[model samples]
Target: MGRRHYILPDCQIRPGDPTDHLDWIAADIIRRKPDVIVCIGDFFDFPSLSSYSTPGGVEKEGARIKADLDAGHAGLERLMAPIHAERERLRTGHRKRWEPRLIYTFGNHEERIDRPAKEDARFQGVLGTHLCEVERFGFERYEFLVPVEVDGVWYSHYWQSSHSPRPIGGTVDNRLNKLGFSFVAGHEQGLRYTNRPLPNGKTLHGLVAGSCYLVTEGYRGPQASNEWRGVVVLNDVRDGNMAIPMSLDLQYLCREYAGEELQAYMDKRYPDKDWSHLA
Candidate 1:
C-alpha cells in the first residue's frame, strides 16, 4: 500500500511575520493524518545573521539573534500545537496515536546560523542547528542541501546544478530531464510540477513549490510575491510514484480553516502593505 505525504514548502519563519497560516497547516494535518510530513527547511529566517546588508548597517540594527530564534521556535510551536492536541485527544480516548514521520531538510536561510561559528572559533559551540531544537519536535533534521529519500521519493531544500553549487534553475520538465528521478524541492517561489515515464515502467516526478508563508520579501516586489503560497499533499506514493498530488493554496486554507478570506486577512493584519496581487 502507498503512503500519503504532506509537504510544507519554505516557511522562512522570522520575527514580525504573521504565523497564523502555520496553524491552518497543523489543523489540516490533523484532518489528513498523512503518514509522513516533510518540511523543505528555511523554517527560520535569521535576518540578524543575513549578509545582505553591510556590517553594522541600519538594516541590521536591532536584529537580535535571540529574536530570530525565538520567533522561529514560537512559530514551530504554533504549527505543532493542534497536532499535539489531537494526539492527546486520541490518547485520552484510547485510540492509536497519529505519529507521522517528520523530516526537515535545512535550507539556505537556516544555513546562515553556521556563518558566525564558521568565521570565528569563539562562536563555534554556541551557534548551530541544536539551538533551533527541531529534534525536540520529533523532526529528523538533515543538513542544508542534503537529499533524503522517503517512500521512494527524494527530497532536499533544492537540488544543485551539475556544474555549480547553486540550485538548479529551470522549469519542472527541465529539472526532470536533468535529475531524472522522483524529486521534490522548495526554494524558488511558486509551484511547478511535471512527470515523465521511465523505460523500466515507473514514473519520475519533479516538483518545486517554495513560498508557504504570509510574509513578503520586499525584493520580490508585488508581482513576484503574488505567486501561490501553499502546501502540497501527495497520495498513493510508493516506489517513486505519486498517483495524486493536491495543492492547497493559502487562500483556500484560510477560508477552509479560519473562516476568513485570505485577502481580507492580509489586509486586516497588514493594513499598510499592498497585496495587489490578490486582486
Candidate 2:
C-alpha cells in the first residue's frame, strides 16, 4: 500500500491586498495530492469580533461590528476562493477513491471570540452561525480535537493536558510516548522545534507541525530570532513503517511566488518598518 502524507499549513490570513502565495500553496497541494490537509489554526487573522447591546433596545454596536465582520469575511472569501475550489474538486474526485479528511483547530485568536460569548447563548449562537459560513466556504473543516487513524497511526490537533500533579508521563514528550502515536499541534507560531525519536528501544515518535504564515509585526521587531515561516509535511511510510519530515521553505516560496507584489503590499501597510530582509 502507498504511504499516507499529511500536510499541515498554518494560514493566519490577515486583511491585505490578497497575495498570490495563497493560490500557489493551494496549487502545490493539488499537485502533491496528499492524503489529508490539516490547517494548524488561525486561518483568519481577525475575522471574528465581539459586541454588546445597549439598554435602549438598539444593537448599534452589534450592527457595526457585524458589518466589519461581513467585510472581512468577503475579503477572505475572495482570497481563499481558489483554495476552496481545489478542495471541492478533491472532495468530489475522491468520493469513490478515498474519503480524506480536512481538519481545522481553533487557535488562541479564535478562542477569544468564544470566551465572551460563552455566557450568552444568543451571542454563542451568532458565533456558531458565522463559523458555519467559514466551514461552508471550505476555509476549515474539523474543530476541536479531531482524531484520525491513517495506516494505523492516530493524530490530534491538541495533545490532551495531563492530569497528574507530578505526572511521569505528563510532559509533552512523555505523553506522546505513552500514547504510542504521532501527535501534531500548532498553537505556537513558527518552526522552532520538532522531536522525532526512533521507536527502537525508545518509546514513540512525535512530530510538531510548524506555522506557515508570516510572523506578526510585533514578533518581527525586537523579539525577532529564528522566526522562520514554513509548514511541515509528514510522510506516513506504510511499506517501511516510518515517518519522514519535509519542511516547505515558505520564505523562498513567498518570495518566488509572491514576488514584488507582496513586498509592495507590506511596504504600503508598514511604511515605517523594513521587511527587505525577508526573502
Candidate 3:
C-alpha cells in the first residue's frame, strides 16, 4: 500500500574470524523481516583465488587456500541457511504477500575476480555458485549498479555527474535535487542523506547505505582513522517520499567476532607502513 522498506547490509564478509559476520547479519535480517535485502558488495573479502598468495607470488600450493575458501563457504551457508529456511517458512502460508527478495551488486574486491588469468577461476567459481544460490532464493543480481524505483523514486549504486570534483557528495540535496527522483546508493561505507530545495519549491532526497562489517586492518595512513561500519533501513520509499535521515546504525558485528588472533594476523601481514589513506 506504500513504499516498501528494504534492508541493506554492507560488506558482510571478509577474511576475518571463524565466526563469520554473515551468519550474524543473516540472523538479524530474518528476525527483523524486511521486504528485501540488498548487499552493497565486498560480501567476500578476496573474491579471486589469485589474491591469496605469498609475497613471492607463489600461490597456496595445495588445499590450504581451498580449505580456507571452503571454511568461508561453510560460514556463509550457516548464515544464509536461516534466511532460506525462513523464506520457505513464510512462503507456505502467504505465497502472494511474502515473496522476499535478495539483491547483490559487485564491489571493487569482487572486480578482481574478473581479472586476467586462471587464478581468477576460483573467484568466478565461487561467485557463480553464490549467484545460483541467490537465484534459488528468488533474489536478483545486478552488475556494478542498477536503477530501482521505490515509491516513484529512482535508485542506483553509482551516480553520474559532470563535475570533476569528488565523485560522491555527502548530501543528497546536491546530487538529486533537480533530478526529479529519490536516490539511494552504497559503496562509501557511511550513512548519509541530504534534502535540497528544488527550483519548483519542493525538495530532493538522497541516501547512502553504509557498511555492516569491520574496516580491514590493512588500512593505514590518513584513512586509518576513518573506519566505520553499519547497516541501513529504508523505512518508507514507496509512497513517493524519502525516509527522513535514512535509518542506519553503526555496529561492530564483524570486529567483535574477528577475535584477537585474526586481527594480529592481519596486522602482521599488512603492516602499518603499507597502509593507504583512501578507502
Candidate 4:
C-alpha cells in the first residue's frame, strides 16, 4: 500500500534481451514517477541451472542456452540508468523531489542457481547467494520470490495459494480467483486483468504482467505471442487501494507514445506483424 507502485514483470534476461520495451520503460518511469518500482521475478535466466542444459553446450566458451553473468549486469545497468538520472534531476529540481524505492523479487528461474549448490558442495556458495549480481545498485532483494505488500496490495514473482485445499492452475485469473487479496505478478508471462466484488465494500483485482524479452527460444515459444511485452503502472494508491490512471500497461504506453526509434526496433523485429489485437 504505497502511493504508487510500478510493477515490472518477469524479464528472463539473457540473449536478445533489454527488449525494445526496456527503453520505453526507463523513459516511462521518468514521466510517471511512481513511489516504488517492483521488478516481479525471473530477472535472470541462469541457463547453467536449466534441467535441459547440455554439458557440451556449457563447455563451449559460448552456448545459446548459457547466460553470461556480466551481460546480465550490463542489461540491468542500461535499464536502471534512466531511473537514477531522473532521481538525481529531482533531488535538485526547482522544488519537488523524486526518489522511488527499487525492489526485485527472485523468481523460479533465478532459483536455478540452487541446484548446483545443492548437488556439489564445492560449488556451493561459490558465487554470491543471490540472483542479481548488481545488488550493489541500491535495490531491496526479496528471496524465494516472496511477495511484498504495499498499500494492502501484494506484489510477488507468482502467487502460490497454499491455503487452498488443492492446487489451482497457474494463471493470473486462477491466482486472483483463489486468493482473497489483490495482487500483481509476473512469471506466467501472460497478461490478464480481472476484478471481482467483495462483501466488505471493496474489490479485488489481479494483474499479470507481460515479459520484457525480445523473443522466445524453446518452451517459452509457441505461446510467446500471448505474452505481453511491457510494464504495468500502478498509481493513486491509498491504503493499498488504487486507481488506474495515466497508464495501466507499459506496452500500451509505448504503443501509444513511443518514439520513432523504438518503433523502428519493433518493426525490424516483427516486419510482417499487425498489432490490431493489442489495439
Candidate 5:
C-alpha cells in the first residue's frame, strides 16, 4: 500500500476554528491511518503583528500578542489531540512497526515571532520564541521556507525557488508551470488544483490547499470568494497524484464521523446555546 498524508494548510488559529471539522477528520485519519499528517502552515494568526493591526502605533501590543498566542496554543491542542492519540495507539499496541507522525509547517504569520527579536536587542530572547519549540504538540516542525517531502509531493509555506525566474506566485497553476513538480502550500486562501499528464501514464498535480477559519478581512474583497476553508486529503500519494480540498461542514462532519461526541466537550463548557456554528 502507498503512503497516505492529510494536508491541512493555513489554519490561522486566533479566535480559531471549530474542533468539529478537525474532529471529524481525526476520525477519518484514524481510519485512513496515514503514515504522515501535515498541518501545512500558518497554524497561528498573530494579528497583533499585522501592519493593519497597529496602523498608527503599537497599543497594548503585548496583550494582543499574548491573547493570540493563548488561543493558538489551545487550538493547537484541540487539533492535535485525536491524531496524537491514534498515533500513540498504533505504535504502542497493534502496529508496532507503524510510526505515524504529525508535521507542522511554519507559515509567515507564525513567523511573526521572529520580528520582535529582529527589531529589539534586550528583548530578543525574552519572548515570542515558542515557535522553535514543538515538543509539546508532538509535531515535527519545518520553517516557512523549508520544504518537507512525503512520498513525492513537497509541502512548503510558499513556492519561489531561486532556480526559477523570480516568483510565479502562489496559485497552483503558477507553481505547476514554474516548478514542474508537485507542491502543496498555504498563505493563499481558497482551494485550487492543476493536473498535468506525464508520458508514463502518470498524472502530476499541485494544490493550493487553502485555509480553515472564521476570521475574514475586508481586504479579501467584499464577497471573499477568493478565500476558502477546508483540508486536503491525499491517499496513496506518489508522483503528485492528489486530492482536491474538500470543503468541510464541521458540524455535519462531527455528527457523522466523529467517534466521540464532540458535543460532550461543548455541553460542559456551554450548557446552553447551540455551538453548531463554532469557528
Candidate 6:
C-alpha cells in the first residue's frame, strides 16, 4: 500500500506568539492518520540566541533562553496533545494504536544553541540541543542542515550547495536541477515546488516550504510577511517519487479545524495588531 507523508514546515514557535496552529495541525493529523509525519525544522525560534543580532544588544534585550525553551516545550505539547488523547482513547477501546513515524530536522534557528556554546566554554554544558528534549516527544532529531531520507525521498532543513556552506539559492527548478533527486525541505519562507522526469519515466520532486505559524516577524516588515504558510501532504509516495502534493494552508486548516475563518480568528485573538498581510 502507498504511504502518506505529512510535511510541517518551520513553525518558528517562540515566546509571545500564538500556538493554536499546533492544535489545528494535531487535529488534522488525528483525522488523517498519515503513515509518516515530518517536521521540516525551526520548530523553535531561539531569538535569545540569534546570531543575526549582537548578543546583549538592544535587539537581544529582554529575550530569555528559558522563556524561549519553555514556549517551545508548551507548543510541542499542544501539538502532541490531540494525538496523545487519540492514542489513549484507542487503547481504552482496545483498538489498534495509530502511531506514525515522527521526524524532526534541526533548522538554522535551532543551531543557535550550539554556535555560542561552541565558541564559549562557559555555555558548553548549559546551552545544548538536549535542553529541548525532542527525543522525549518520540521524534528522531537530526542535526542542523543534515538530510534524512524516508521512503526514497531526501528530507533536510535545507539542502546546501556542494561547494559552499550556504543553501542552494534560486528557484525550485534550480534546486531540483542541482540536487537531481526527490527531496523535501524547509528554510526559505513560502512554498516553491518543481519536478523533473527521468529517462526511465520516473519523476523527481522538490519542495521548499517554510513559515507555518500565524505570527509575522518584524524583520519581514509588512509586505514580505504575506508569504504562504501551512503544511504539505504527499500521497502515493514510493521510491523517492510522489504524485502531485496537496497544500494545506493556514486559512484552510483554521477554517476546518478551528471552525473560524483565519481573518476572524486573528481579529478576535489579536485585535491590537494589524494582520492585513496575513489575509
The local distance difference test score of model 3 is: 0.53
Sum up the clashes in candidate 1.
0
Candidate 3 regions off by >4 Å?
Answer: 16-20, 47-76, 92-97, 117-133, 160-172, 177-180, 197-203, 221-226, 245-279
Each prediction's whole-model lDDT (CA): 0.89, 0.53, 0.53, 0.67, 0.68, 0.89
For residues 13-65, what per-residue lDDT tens digits would candidate 5 score against the true structure? Answer: 76433444565666766766678878877878777777556554554245467
TM-score of each: 0.95, 0.67, 0.65, 0.81, 0.78, 0.96
Per-residue lDDT of candidate 3, residues 52-171 (tens digit): 556444333442333444544565576668877877877777664445556665554444444533345555554443432344434566655545655565545656554752344545
Residue-wise C-alpha lDDT for candidate 2, range 1-28, written one tens digit per residue: 5565655545555444233455556556
**What's model 3's TM-score?**
0.65
Q: Which residue pairs overlap in candidate 3's backbone? A: 3-238, 151-238, 211-230
Clashes of each: 0, 0, 3, 3, 0, 1
Candidate 1 lDDT, 1-279, residue by residue in tens: 999999999998878888889989998999999999999988899989898977798878889999999999998899987887898899999998888999999999899998888999999989987788898787999999889999889999999998999988868899888887899999988999988997888999998988898877877786676788999999999999998579999899999998999888888878997656654
Cα-based RMSD of the predictions, in order? 1.4, 6.2, 6.9, 4.1, 4.6, 1.3
Better structure of 4 and 6 per TM-score: 6
Please write out the lDDT profile of model 6 over residues 148-229, one tens digit for every residue: 9899999999999999999999999999999888999999899999888899989999999988989888888876888999
- What is the TM-score of candidate 2? 0.67
lDDT of 4: 0.67
By TM-score, who's the top model here?
A: 6
Top-down lDDT ranking: 6, 1, 5, 4, 3, 2
TM-score of 1: 0.95
Q: How far off is model 2, as Cα RMSD? A: 6.2
